[model samples]
Target: MTTSSSDSTSAAASQPGRFRVGVQKFGSFLSGMIMPNIPALIAWGIVTAVVVNVSEFTEAGWEPTNALAGVIFPMIHYLLPILIAMQGGRLIYETRGAVVGAVAAVGVIVGSDHIIDQFNAALPAGEDQLGYVHMFIGAMLMGPLSAWLMKKLDAVWEGKIKPGFEMLVNMFSAGILGFLLLAVGFFVMAPPINWLMAALGTGVEWLIDNSLLPLTSVLIEPAKVFFLNNAINHGVLTPLGTQQADAQGSSILFLLEANPGPGLGLLLAFSVFGVGAAKATAPGAALIHFVGGIHEVYFPYVLMKPALLLAMVAGGMTGVTTNMLLGVGLQAPAAPGSIIAVYVQSLGGGVGNVVGVTFGWVLSAGVTFAVAAVILLSSRKRDMELGDQFSAAIAKTEAAKGKSSSALASLSAGVPSAAADRIRTIYFACDAGMGSSAMGASVLRNKLSAAGISDVYVTNKAISSLPGDADLVITQQTLTERARPKEPQAIHVSVNNFMNAPEYDEVVELVQQSGDDQAVAAGSEAPASSAEHASGTRTAVEPRVLTQDRIRIRAGSATQEEALREAQEILVSAGAVTGDYLQAMRDREATASTYMGSGLAIPHGTNEAKSSIKSSALSVVRYDGGVDWAGDQVRFVVGIAGVGDEHLQLLARIAELFSDESKVAQLEAAASEAELHALLSGVNDN
Candidate 1:
């Protein structure tokens, strides 16, 4: 399938402007540093909640001097900041970068503490002492900066170190550089960051005092549609909110951006007064946004008719004003802005606090719904005449977010009715051929297999490698535009999450019905049952490719790269491939993700590295905690070195086994390597 050059060019020209893209990227980066550390923050919040009134627990025979109270200060003052720095550093330079970044962060932390103490001592008699300044801002700055510098330094000495002395040189060089960065952070970074945080806090206090904080919704609501919500919430608000929470036990700053009220109101309005696809999908979208806490679901509705943004802003202001008037706030950041999370965080303040927070969100949601309903009703006639703009708005939302989300895919317009019969080959396309696309392909393939549909072939590829003959092309929403030009004749489906999307079920239903219709038209017998159509013959031969030694169970957790290396090492030891195949495997992953879904990942070398293979073989390892495969959980890693089509039969058998939910659970719960190997070998029986 193909599109005309003119149509493709026009579509490209209509993409979100450069400035919006830049802002979204910056916001994503900022949130990236904080998002990974949220679990730690949550842990701290829990501890704080428990110790807020330790005296209350004494009635239950709890000791007054409960040592658990000590965990509160160290976690916020030291552990969290360092973890954020290490994560930021890891993003820039991996492990070595993380080490250096941590060293630099410590310097700033200690320097700030010392400064605070000195200021307290110098104050006039009986004056209030300044609170300790947490160095989160300093950590965010120094972590990445130090790692980048270390990366540059390492680049300069690349290939210069003698083979045997490499370790010594590398260690000393990193140590010396880390020492220098530590001193630099203490002297240069801490003071400015401390001052900046103080100024920002003062500004926020002024706004609250002047009753102008609600006006921030004008900026926040619009920025959220552009996908800047994370940057504003985590990057700017979380840090400030944490400080206020530390001093006063709660902070309204956390409620400002994390409120789900505005998004709920907007989605409700669409459900009640919208037209066409927008109206049809709104009710479900509202469930996801308000209950599932995925606010991105409602972004396209606003984009479809931008005038609706006024309703969002009004709702935001109402929520803020209500919370402010009630003097209610959360003890911690309410991530995803879910009502459930907000209530959980409000628990420490007792029932009155909970009621106030609840009332605030309800009032905000009501106002937003009222305003949006009016706007939608006023434009209903014009909207109906103008036709459905939901699809275009979805595209714009994807463009702004810079990725396709499975959440949005559920709400996207369905595949054209006619395309169902034409879809014989379904290709899941992504930037790299490895990750979500492979997972989506595997999932759809399993469905087809179970449905007794043998004619359809499901596969995955990088967008650049998509074949023109593709009958159906599935991609993340962000990549749909790029994919259309490559296979314009094929039906294009955009999804945010590939593992589980409602669209996949709709596609399956369509294909099955289409097959039934074709059978009726030909006056032939109905299609065979699922059991009758299942492929592969039961084999008596013992498996040579999967041996007991090649299987590992309960392997400890490791990063994606580490797990990949371990898989390749097993293959190398078996003489299936040369050591160089590891790099080729990495190159293949770099080109596209290799995640096959269902808690499995198959990492293999690229076509160009075929010469490195000595024989066909497979290495399997089970990670108890699961490997983080490009943000997806992969419990089983299978490293492959195939010679021609020799491994295809094995792969098919494995895929078939994983397709069964009960079998996947068994694999995860396997007690030993031999037990795991026995389950894997059983694939040949089918």
Candidate 2:
């Protein structure tokens, strides 16, 4: 939600020690398992809302019954926890651990009590033995602990157990341990754990009854901004709220942390009263945050203006107070805070609850919008400057760190063999496909539209469901590992920030370059001459030397000689020039450094060294980490391994590309070799 880098470990790693990083990674792992199941949680919420609130006709007359509860309650109290435990176990120690994790979770379920005395009150005296244990919390704890314990056991038993008896030993060990843990949970821990939960639930109920629950937003609003909303809601609030729901009819905690009204209000304010790009982006963010139920979309907006935090707190307090005063609370958690999901979850509270939540939503939105508008209007000049600074920061991130190559030889001779045409569809992937990735896709889609680029299709997908034909895959740095293996052939681009505008702009330019290349191929029905290319520099030099494989986009060389040698390797591999050409180039560089202005450094051998060249050729290398060319900081290194006057025309084309700083920046940020080759192919076609 905040504007910090999205790597799961970044916040933890930013702390002063290794302990913090380890804790962060562990927390992130658990979060990964939990966040993907929000849809499942919503379904469970719907079931709870309907089963508890709705009644149907019976044989005698229309009456209420808990029959429908039997169908889904077991899933909430048992199956879901086991599933969560299995997932956590698998994540920690693979299949063996997963099996053991589910077994161990059963112990927690058997020991923990879900209904306790609440069931006695619902039933006639002495006949109230019916009670179910909600094992979600216990399952979360026991699953990982059991997996870790089993892992240790396996390590100790390794090579000791006979090969023939290994399976028997493994199965008996898990079974015995699980039985022992179950006994301990049931005999010694269940009562105390259930008591603690009951106490917490009681505190929440007291707050609601006393009409002091609105004050809880002072803590809840800030926690949500820091990405702790999921942990708070699912781990603490939901379980407590569910226990209360079982006792009474509903719990106010369900609506406390999940009210999307505050975010919706802030976005409405930004859309109406904000200035520049922030204002333009707010309307789309408002739609996503409100109807789509992704409250995260507005967090960065608040973070950008810290004063707007007061607005969020005010909105949250207003919403909670309104719901409390109306005596309305949801039967279950309304995940994602989406309006539709909230309405479904409010079924347990009947018409009053629905009206109350709706009014609260409007009230919070109105308060947040009014407060935020005043903040923006009062600091218009400062807000505009900060907006520009944010954009600049994004641009710097997109430009990464690399030196641009000075090798013209690869561009002319290697001649992008085949990689240019392969990439067409670009995918933006995230942990959950529905939230961040969708917003990223929309951003890029709009950018492409503005650039008048129609052929390229930009879309979003979950990391697991990545498509086969995705020519390029974009994901946050942490989740890139998941997206890469699924589409190994696709060009992978990882960024720390998905919402950064400059990152989207870079991707758009790349797609545009590819489109231009496609147009070039279509218009000519053949590879056009150098003059007919997009950059408008005609060249007589052969295109064979500048193959796709020879063009290195975003190479990480630290110096001029290193860049030149890298370029030489590409040329030699392509059979365009001899390896000894590197030496010849060095001798020429010793005479005078080839540091050209406009972030270009043209490195080449003297005329005398034409004997070392296989033929007249050029190699184009873009270095994102600017290399030191004698005294100049060079970004592009065009390696000239060509012989005689034939290479002169190619130099002209290189000069033309170097002259335009904007185009040079785009080339420097190119995500793949194909994109770079496409840009080169379009050089004179423009």
Which candidate number maximizes lDDT? 1
Deviation in Å, model 2, residue 327 alpha carbon: 2.0
lDDT per model, in order?
0.77, 0.63
Q: Candidate 2 at residue 499, lDDT?
A: 40
The sequence of per-residue lDDT tens digits that candidate 1 reaches over residues 269-302 is: 8888999889889999988887888888899999
Candidate 1: 10-residue stretch with minimal lDDT: 522-531
Model 1: lDDT of residue 132: 91
TM-score of each: 0.74, 0.55
